[model samples]
Target chain A: MSTVVVLAPIIVANWPVITAVVGAAVGSLGFAVVRGEETSQQRGETTTREEIEIDNSEILTSDTGFEEEIVVQREGVRAIFSRDARGVLRVCMEGRGTSHAELRRWGQELIDRVTQQYAYHRIVTELKARNMTIVDEQVEEDHTVKIRVRSW
Target chain B: MAKEELEIEISPSGKVTARTLGVKGPRCLELADLLARIVGREESRTLTHEYYETERQVTDQVDLYGHR
Candidate 1:
């Protein structure tokens, strides 16, 4: 080994790419994507809602004048992901019977998964663009992803 | 042709640690920079002993060739 580097991933992507990562994250966490109208209807029944803002994340879009949001539901808990006016990503979790703590935990989990998926996607895409081939890839018990790539 | 290898480990929290293997001198940093751009800002960087060893070998080779 020659050089080692540690990086903290900052999520910056277009709306469609952000949606894709959010979809992958929610799917892995056993959450199903719900239509915006369906989520709006479900919100009427929710009693408690907690919002968590993810730091170091931004949604880059040419048309930032419009708002976009994605909602996912699992086990009666709903998470709505959206970008604030400043483009920072936020998730609001709500459920009728779920405690605020539970909602917060679920929101945290979702954001963590989103960040991981975004980083993995960016790394793989950039590496492939540079003509590098992934020789091995594995996920550890702790959910850390290890990838070995080679360039000749 | 020589093969350059990079081992990247992304933690669950989305922090990335990348180590370049079998790459000599400053060339290893190029790979690390590429990853930094893809992921985010680099938190820290460390050059292993092998980096210096390779630099020494290259300098020695240059000296030997110049002496000839």
Candidate 2:
């Protein structure tokens, strides 16, 4: 990827889920974010959209306002943290039946529980992480990924 | 006897790679800003060579608050 690394998609456990069909159509929910971005979606149809599921939702349930359609079958996967081209900092998971060793075991248990829960602060002790690899495995298709990071 | 090297890589499809060793430049964005606040959201960012030898950029881009 070239540029576009300021994103968020962390939907823990799973909220009420469709809570009354997206809270009564979430007032014709419009995409707060647009332009080629979506993960974990398997309830597809109505036109064209593969997947993209990032929760902690804003309570918007598509009526085709912001082009909404996010579902990971049963929300078994959700993760997004990117920046490649050697810049490092990677955490990417594609959804839609979420598989690929269970999204690489939930992206390696969310980076070892977010690096020991933020290892005593100080911006994570200045970028110190090492241990992980499985860059390719496309269980047929729709579940893609590529990972690697290193420094000093 | 040298120790203080970090390298984290988690791929298979869910991506995340953090590599830091002996620390560098103002702690390299304090180590890539605490792993960009733990995969909450960060699509892109670049700075190495110990993140240009960061003197200070403490990492502050909050405003995600409740994560809506």
Candidate 3:
């Protein structure tokens, strides 16, 4: 008798096991559920613009409410998140630069730059063994010095 | 399942660093190579216990003393 060896595709293994597997995946990634299910920081503040766009100009809180903002008032680098009218998560980085595009570009960049300073980014740094640039120049924004990246 | 995680950061100065985790073997090097190709700066890397290790650490290259 002969035995056969096979290399199967590594999937979530599909449902009715899907829900359980998703839960496991979420838990592994250090996430908890509030409403009905799984994981991580989503950049949305489900509120009116008037509520989020206050004079302070801060971004809306994360879905899990585990959110943060770092602003260098003296050096002019600011990162903020908020939920727009459409209820999408938005991360906007503000800083001073020569042109509008330049400021926006730098704003997006500074977010990634400052992030690596934190503990989480530290793991990412150790894992990657190289720098990760979150903001690419492909997206264009108004010359407001605010680089806004959105997520669903 | 490819649970790969990557991170890169630059300080107030132009100093930059990169890291990857959960990616077994030299596959992580692909990510490092991509960043080096783009950032164009001579960056240094540190291998951690998350995925791999190095007999020697690549330090002393960055201006570590000037951490402001």
Candidate 4:
């Protein structure tokens, strides 16, 4: 490679885009999405639970639509993905019987998957807009994408 | 007749590297800029011998120590 670069992901997307990517990432990582379920005790019972939620709408403004929360569970790890008022997606990972490092690693993997999917779509669209023809595309064993294009 | 080719590698971690083939001089920079804009920010670039090859020269010696 003549020029090599490292890209730090800049999370900028609306709720729909974020939700699509989050679903894809969740599937790729073997996590099953569970719909809304009660996290508190019923019938006026006083039971304390340490359930962690991933809602960051408290700091959002009025422009961004009402926040939607998604919960995915796998093994002892739970990941909550949501979008804030400013249209930024955030993922919060909590583990019930796992170590802190394991939780962080899982969170990183989710982020990487989402970023890769997003970047692939964005790059293809932008390059096509610049009038470049895609000659070939390959996905490596590690899931990285290599694309060959011709400008003229 | 040879055609200009740009090989773009997007890592799983979202890094991008573009290698230009059959393009020389300032045109290489243009290709790199195009790829960078499509990918993300420009981190660093290393100029190859082909990068130094001019449109008016016929040199074939490989120079491998150019970086910026």
Give the candidates in order of lDDT, highest first: 1, 4, 2, 3
- Which 10 consecutive positions of candidate 3 chain A have the poorest summed lDDT? A1-10
Q: Give the CAPRI rating of model 2.
A: incorrect
Weakest ten-residue segment in model 1 chain A by summed lDDT = A36-45
lDDT of 4 by residue, A1-152 (tens): 33434444344555656666667667768887777653223334443223222222122333456447677777756677765555456676766566667777788777677677766776778878888789999988888789888877
DockQ, candidate 3, vs. native dimer: 0.02
**Best candidate (score: lDDT):** 1
Clashes of each: 0, 28, 21, 0
On the 0 to 100 scale, the lDDT of residue A71 in model 3 is 20
Query: What TM-scores do the predictions have?
Result: 0.91, 0.23, 0.25, 0.71
- The residue pairs in collision within model 4 are none
Q: Candidate 1 at A92: error in angstroms?
A: 0.8
Q: Who wins the DockQ comparison?
A: 1
Docking quality tier of candidate 3? incorrect
User: Where does model 3 exceed 4 Å of error?
Assistant: A1-152, B49-68
In model 2, the Cα lDDT at residue A58 comes to 34
Q: Roughly what TM-score does model 4 have, to 2 decimal places?
A: 0.71
Candidates 3 and 4 compared: the better one by TM-score is 4
What CAPRI class is candidate 1? high
